[model samples]
Target chain A: MNSSSYYRNNIAAVYIDANALQLEPVQRAISKLTHVRPQTVTSVAEIPAAQRNLRTLYVTSFRGAALSACPGTRVHRCCNYHTVDLYAGCPLGCSYCIMQSYLERSAVTVYADPSPAITAIRAQALAAPEVPLRVGSGETGDSLLLDPLFEITRRYISELADLPNVHFEAKTKTDFVDHLLDLEPKGNAVIGFSVNARQFAVEEGASATLAQRLDAARRAARGGYRVAFHFDPMFRSGSSDGSPAAAAYRDVARRIAAAVDAGRIAWISLGTLRYTPALKAQIKRPYIHDEFVGCADGKFRYIQRERVALYRSVVAALQQYLCPQPPIYLCMESDTVWQRVFGWLPQQINELEALFAGAPLRGESV
Target chain B: MQMERVATLVQRVGPLDIFDQTRLPPDQLIRQGLTAVLALAPLHDSAAGATDAAEAQLLWGGPIVRRAAEIGVGELPARRLGPLGHRDALMLALRMEARAGGYSWSEREAIHRYAGEHRVALDTELSQLVTAAQTFAESMERYLALAPIWRRAVEAGAVDVRTAELCGALPPAVLDTVSGAGRRLSFSNRRLVLTWLSELCGRDGLHEPAAVELAQNVMQSADPLDALRRLRYPRLSAMEDRFAALQRRLTQGTPLELKAPPEFEGAGYEVQLTLRSRDDLARAIEALQRMQEESDELFELL
Candidate 1:
């Protein structure tokens, strides 16, 4: 099938590529977010046959910006909003890879084109020249994992160095800091990593181990790269009551303590494993099941009571490590989680703005 | 004074017990029901008009209503009496007589033409009207054959819940001035939930473990507001919040994912040279054009 089969959002038509037919049945399923039937055709020539009976929509990208409205994590992070999508899917098969289930197409697609994204960043920065443009590219896919393959980190440091106000955050799990050692480390850019404890990382995650991640963070910081850590998808596996939950929380707390220098951390994000019902089924699908994850609400894994305690314990543990206590942000979470974990829920914007401001700005406590 | 005359007219009419007629054969019922409805046309028209205009309209009416008037069908009753009472009465009578038994295709054609001639729209007023009517007729035929048995069952209190349900389609929800099911969600979602639950129970052969699992998943989602948040309809934010809250309640204990959904992929960039300086734009454009050309050449070789 032509490239369009991988992108169209709305329509009902089978996509078949001549080259694809001889291989494995493209194991990708249709995404409910976009109404489009997909079938991989054997021949590229038969692209017309696929299109003959149905509507095909053209799109440059399906997932939007990675970091859209910067919940200002660092005063130095882009003041304005920007996003970068470094890649589509990660090789590290985390069972809950949101993309694994959401993307209806099976193959991985990396945007080789970087100029348009850079131009867009430049335009957005210029639009709000005075305001810092908060932009990161690791949202759609792991930003740094593919960096070695494409020398992306090098490209970013060399090409995007001139735009002082345009802060670009490379959120990734791969260690490619050496590539950026020669380039002047701009205060605007921040390096982010999704991290978990060694045990959890070994059990549930497929990213770099805790030691590898800590080394990457230390090296990046030594090279003057502002670093941030995401305690996302925190595993809360014990029972709902006090001690089981406390143990899970303590383990997470201990991990965050040793991962990075407190002074160097730009911010720490606390996010629990939450998923939609559809993703829940995909989670239970025999091929993708993992025992480390437990259903909390229904489809959302991570036991509920355990999750709240975990969040509280992580934040508490981080307070001891951070000097000014690096500002904390919760990703895709409810106001209740914010209140239950951090004593208050910052305004839709303010709670996030604290991350970028270098301090938690006072917000109405709910 | 006028009410007594109307009652006398209804009593005199041959179609009064139309809803109760079960033994009439197919051809006979068709002939009788068709004739009765045709006969009542004039009375309905006259009754529908103002009291003063009733006589004039009846006198000048079309053939269908005129024939109805000749059969002693008087004015249709007042609207306060309800449409079901006046309009449905005659129709039910006709149904009891003419269509109580199955009709052949030709018989159906005759009925269709007759209904058209008298201005009756089938299958539209109530959903599945034609199918229901056919079922009702077949039931009537069966009842005629087993009237004594059915009567005995009724007398013995052996009529089941199924029979009571078949007495009529489910009654409309009671309208409460303050709050009710109607004010809560559209009937369609309610019906969807009901049908979904029914199918999950293996009623309509859709009793899949996955369906039940999905329902459970949606329910158990902690956010509780998750379902409404993802509604693709309406697009307005307010409606989304409302839908999310409702979905949360309906999907309690259901499994659902709470993550950023997946997205598709595309090429890296497109060049748009909109610099203020034409020279800058031209230079950038030239550079992009050259890069595109080179890439195309490289692609061709690959």
Candidate 2:
């Protein structure tokens, strides 16, 4: 893990929901991490508007079901992945983040408690033992970027260990796994890192560098946790020689192969850069000028052919460089893309065969 | 914030010609039929141009004054309030005019500019009055910030507010050239050309006439949209053109409508063949056979 903490030095203040102050872990985390005196507030409306951005911290309890399906982009194939919202905002200011468009407030918020989420997962995994539950904690925020400060995700990793068919992956763009290194039984856990080419790293804000993240992957794999990589929002460099984006992704693939045991890699996912209308207005980079066509889900992405080419190049690099191939899937892609890339769609359970013992019928989380 | 000012005193009425008509906001509809004139400064030439409405502080009746000028009607049959503080006068005028049915971008710009200069804080009121998708300050900054020519481009309905704002990011010289080119296009096509030009400038780090020059040089047809789209999406456009050419060659001007998905974003081409008799069926089959013979090339485009 890097020594300088983005969360620790950047957090200007902390506000906890009044009801949540009774939670034991909340007090412990504040004492260990928060430098400023924490404020107790009844609701977010009570906080000053100026203090509602990422510099301020808000610890509130999530009232909805903590565990839910990915709400996969409509008109795209469902990956059957489930997500848990341990936190709702990140300090790492990735330039293209879609969260910028929709989050009503910019403050980094912690859900304060993970007990209900863990309980729900245990019951579901036990009830549907045959279904592979590839649950993640990175839906609304980076899994490990803030995990070290709150130490909430480790509970899921530690408790879900005995569930044979379940994998609790904590995805992060940062190389912060040191705190969880000492847990005796790390469980059925995979430390997933969002990996991208160095060209794309410039816009990812204060996330750990590619080299630092690779080192973290090596550490996690050696620590007996299966690791995964997500090459999402891949860019196209518009050259046959592949000097910029595609070649750089291939180089990243080579670095991953060099960094960890390929057999220990649980999965990899690919997605081209896409932005909603709200996010499109916030972006002012050269990348905003890319040749993108609006998808059926109302998000703009690289035209289908361009995306297929990108996926093919990355998948080929991963297959060629790794001794034992890992399961690779397209994130939020349509059926046409699936057919074009993999020659068939996974129509039923276990059709992906190696990806999972596969997911159950539609609407069921993987 | 609802803007409601107490009814000010209307001391007198004079000839419409004496009241200095041109000093009013451009359209009375914008002022919702101005209730009164807050007479303040006296610069004699308020006859035909924007007199910096804020500095002049003259809120003349909108349509009535224009109608008076048009039909030779005498005297404004309207209220005439005395000079108050500059900000107070603006608040009174805005209160009377804020109930307009709808606001065009240009009208909103004028109202926002006047309100902003006065520091009258009509932002909350303006949000309720207009359907701008951005905050009042945001819209004002983006719209007010555009170069004058680009601003005119917006006023003429050549482009939308959001697209015009993007055009604002163009380097001054490049925007000049693009604005000229965009002037020759229809509203929708004008938007397309400008958007493509902005993106091209960003992609190649080219600015000035050069960025627009590159897109303009792609003009192989009378249609700037066609040429600019080709510039923006080269590979996709080429694929589309090639597929269209192939269909023309194979179908040979018959009613064999073969269409690919929009932007090649989907799979499988659609073939709509119209047939009436066996002879028509025979010709359709012949075209289908020809298509089948070249299916590899056709499907490659898809």
Candidate 3:
């Protein structure tokens, strides 16, 4: 379903913070698009407890500096990256969403004020001129869900054009990127789509279908904006013959390879589904099954054997589709898993960061 | 002689009892007014005042007042009070207390008119008394209706008498005040839960004793609804608690980011590391190495 369906089916009302009301253009645009009366709330707490399941659009003033280091735990391997908190929640109710337990409030809250975020990015870019700083907006929420109404990505693209050192990633599970087509190609920004196997894409209740996401990635690639894919939360399906998870990953990779030149693909990240102990209770009952097992990292994860097998299958599939495979990284995995999957682990995290920041492959014009 | 005869007649008439001038019927003493007065008389001392009589008379009329007076003034046991009886007693008490000293003649007249319109025996102007009586009756009925289940529960040895009594006295509607989901529990579902609790208590061996303890614990819990949910979904509750405890242990004393699936359903967990400078990257690497060294204990959760 399209983003409009998310608004129609999920969002019961739209609440705008009073200070955010001052941004008349954004407020009026959202109101007109959603066809919902903009309720003026002084704070996020003003949204009634009863309407929590309904998505609440908060256009409140953000005082804290937006850009910060990704809050990684000590027990897992972390890719040294910074995250820009542009939004607080996502409407796409992926059964595996960490925010279900991480966030106190259920409603999607968008910070109307982007000035502070922009300032922080600029300062980081100026300070670390030599270091390639990858700052993404999808850390706490989906990056592009509200782009059609708020045009937040457009604002970011226009504002961050001067900062060449900072690479901005607008990550999403949606194909709503029509607003970005006409904007000047910044080369510094990447529109990353979080995709999954077909079964999961349909079952997770994400806004965009796999085909729709691939189409959006193709379009972004053709438009000279680099595209990235994240096969995150890879499901360990039980298939006796050939690995069903492998075939699914291969199928999606082939589709992506056919849709756009493989050279335009900047990076592909593989993260197996793992959950903190806190999220087990918050998970929907139907979604809870016997597939998950406790892992040493204090989260539920597939056994190492299963994880390694799934990663190997997907990695092999990806190689067959793309001529020169893009920089693929394992998310939140250990040194042993890295060594087992990719044959080696980087001595320094900066080496991996440098690889992502280096260059895109030269390909035939689409 | 005519003037003296007239004077003697006036004097004789004047000597007659003026209090008996109206010459009320004997039955009038047990009419609506006296009936109300006698009904409420037991609530106070035997030597009742005109105000008490007036209040009781106006609220319950003669027959109900007389019956209430016969019952005497003590807290009536819920078992002894029938629905209609409870309604009449509660309404009478509420109305009398609302206008304790007495009401004005005009107020009394308005009450009488209302009572006439409503075709009730008593002249009660207090609409709230009707609402209060209905509320009380419904509560009492609900409690009594659930009494058998409580009795069965106590007999099954699933719960103590105190817990059974409390549960019996409380209506299912009390769940509505506790939690949002509790409000949506259908009548049948509520009964099923009670049955399930009783069954749990009656289970054999260690499970039975645990169930009994759980029942007692639920009764003593600050949020009974939450306790009930835990009992209903034991496995889920235990898993959640274990998961939370694991998170606390893993995150202790380190800035390492551990990312897991929403419900730990997927294959891979992500460890995210953020670095501002090359030195930060080096520090992150050192931490990762330390984590790698502790992989045996850490990977057990997988």
lDDT of 3 at A282: 55
lDDT of each: 0.45, 0.72, 0.59
Q: Which segments of model 2 are wrong by more than 4 Å? A: A1-4, A238-244, A348-366, B1-101, B104-126, B130-138, B144-157, B172-184, B212-221, B253-255
* Per-model DockQ against the true two-chain complex: 0.02, 0.45, 0.05
- Candidate 3 Cα RMSD after full superposition onto the native fold (Å): 18.5
lDDT by residue for model 2 over B16-43, one digit each (tens)?
1122233345444324534353343322
lDDT score at residue A315, model 1, on the 0-100 scale: 79
Candidate 1 residue lDDT tens string, A142-204:
787545434555555556667777667788775656656556746566788777655455433
Best by lDDT: 2
Off by over 4 Å in 1: A1-82, A202-205, A238-259, A285-306, A347-366, B1-302
Give a tens-digit lDDT track for model 3, residues B79-158: 11112222244345445445532333233334434344434444233443433332323332333444665544433444
**Candidate 2 chain A: minimum summed lDDT over ten consecutive residues — where?**
A355-364
Question: What is the alpha-carbon lDDT for the whole of candidate 3?
Answer: 0.59
lDDT of 1 by residue, B1-302 (tens): 11112333333342122122223234433323332222222234224342321221111112323233445544432112222323343354344344433333233334444344434444333112333443433333333343343333333333422232221111111111101222343334433333223322332222345444444444445532334233211223333354345434433333321111111001122223445566766565555545556554322111
Report residue A171 deviation for candidate 3 (angstroms): 0.8
RMSD of each: 23.8, 6.9, 18.5
Which candidate leads in TM-score?
2
